[model samples]
Target: MHVIAERLIDDGVLEREFTLGEIPGVLWTPPSASASAPAPVILLGHPGGLNGMYPRLAGRARQCAANGFAAATIELPGSGDRPRSVDAEQARADLRRAVAAGEPVDGEIVDRLVLPLVEKAVPEWRTTLDALLSLPEIGGPVGYSGGVIAIGVRLALVEPRIAAAGLFAGSFVPRATFDEARQVTIPLHVLLQWDDEGNDRQMALDLFDAFGSEEKTLHANMGGHTGVPRFAGDDAARFFVRHLR
Candidate 1:
């Protein structure tokens, strides 16, 4: 919970970079946020590598801020400046090799690559939520939005503070995630790119179907992985507003 740097973005959004122990993260609060009128928060999740993901994370944070919610994201384990795992690295190489050879990725490889991440990162996110909500300007009823859907699913099931989630369906989802998805009861807005080259579209659809939330909406669009339309983001923001506000 240490503040390392701070700046004001356009439209008076406050951006702060900080570390919680060894985990580096960024937080953005809107102009209207304050102790007297604390803002609801959105935790932004991503596939590993915060430095490469910063621009998009900042863009999403700005959108959340504009909608009157504080947004924050933490670096995932074995990502960015964090220490790398030899096992995870090997699993990644195996996955890439399979993909490059136009072969189906083995389920074991997917488990090896993603399960440990979900196990480690979910607790980190809970800790981050604890720290973020402790800030005077960031309040409860949190929403989680982004990829690494496994992490989002785990949090939605286990973290009582998270009221809703807007999940991006462009990542590799392991088999065990489907079982977890069935236990998640929070409201969900899942976005899927039908033509995503790197993602298995049917898996995304099945995962969407597996979510046990009584209130869950799927937004499947015709596009590649990075081709999520601008309007989709607007729709996601509205989804958060519906729950977080």
Candidate 2:
């Protein structure tokens, strides 16, 4: 792990930008956080690719820190300093071709586009979790939020370190991931944009119905994929607070 920069931001949150291996991310800690008294941590993931350091992500981290927690986000595979993998690129190209042809982005395209990313990303998230937890300023009762909803599903199933998760349900889910969802029993807050033009509304509902978590909640709003109102985010933040704090 390499520390590239560290500074205090809004609400006295300490933002440290760094790279782990080829993955770059930002770790936000509260001003009072220390190894002797580490703060609760949340792993924030974004859709499509690694988003690196961005406003929404940093804003969420600041909110987490202000509410007495630490938040971190890592670069996903095939993005950022790393180039897109051949297989992932091919899948994306194929999806584009199908979408341009007015064909639904389902079936083989779903497997091709979603599975490869899921296969690579879930373990990478787990690895990132390991590295983040080893840090002195971060501690357990971790929470996860944001996209490539498949990543959230898989992490809920595999990463025992995560105490809870806030999964965005505005992306296509692979057929096999529904079974994986059955294995996830953590406290989950699943967010959905009911009128999302780009997402499969049925898939989101089906996948939510498939979760094995007894403590899961579905938060749906009438909006497009990115048109989710601020209150929905506030609801998710409150959910994280209940579990992480």
Candidate 3:
């Protein structure tokens, strides 16, 4: 965890940009965080491309800080400044072409696009967790929140350090994600955008139903992708506060 830069964002939230080998990431810690009194951390997830996602990620991070928690997010495999995967790029192109033509996306394209990403990204997230937890100012039990829903599913199922997850259900969920979802036992809070053009609403609901968690809640709103309302974010923050505090 090599911190490349640090600045105070606002309300005394300290934002740090860092790199782990080739992967770049950002971490935000609240003023209350310290060795004597560490803050619980939330790992923020996104579809991909950290640079494009920074503003929203930072807003969520500050919200986490406001709620007395630290937040961090790393660029996904083949995203932002990382080396791109040719296979992933092709699969993404296929998806976009299908969407542009108003044709139903083939399941094979989703499998090709998301499955490998899940396989590679989950381990990186676990490694990030390892590094973050080692910091005196950031401690567990950790919470995960955001999209690339498949990544969140895999982490909740396999990563023991994650106590709960608040997943955004606005992406393409591979079939393997449903299989994994059925085995996840951690608490979950899923947000669904009913009118997201790129997402299959039924699939999101089915995936939520497949979750094995004894405690789970779904928040469905009438909006497009990126139209998640502020109140919804407030609700998610409360969800994390209940579990992580």
Candidates in order have lDDT scores of 0.94, 0.85, 0.95
Q: Give lDDT for model 1.
A: 0.94
On TM-score, the stronger of 2 and 3 is 3
Q: Tell me the lDDT of model 2 at 12.
A: 83
Question: What value does the lDDT take at residue 205 in candidate 1?
Answer: 90
Looking at model 2, how many pairs of residues clash? 0
- lDDT measured at residue 6 in model 3 versus the true structure, 0 to 100: 99
User: What are the per-residue Cα lDDT tens digits for candidate 3 across 164-183?
Assistant: 99999999999888999999
Error of 2 at 59 (Å): 1.3
Give the per-residue lDDT digits (tens) of candidate 1, residues 151-211: 9998999999999999999989999999999999999999999999999999999999999
- Tens digits of per-residue lDDT, candidate 2, 99-201, equal 7888888677778888888888888778777888898878888898988898888887888888999999988788889999999999999999999876888
Deviation (Å) of 182 in candidate 1: 0.7
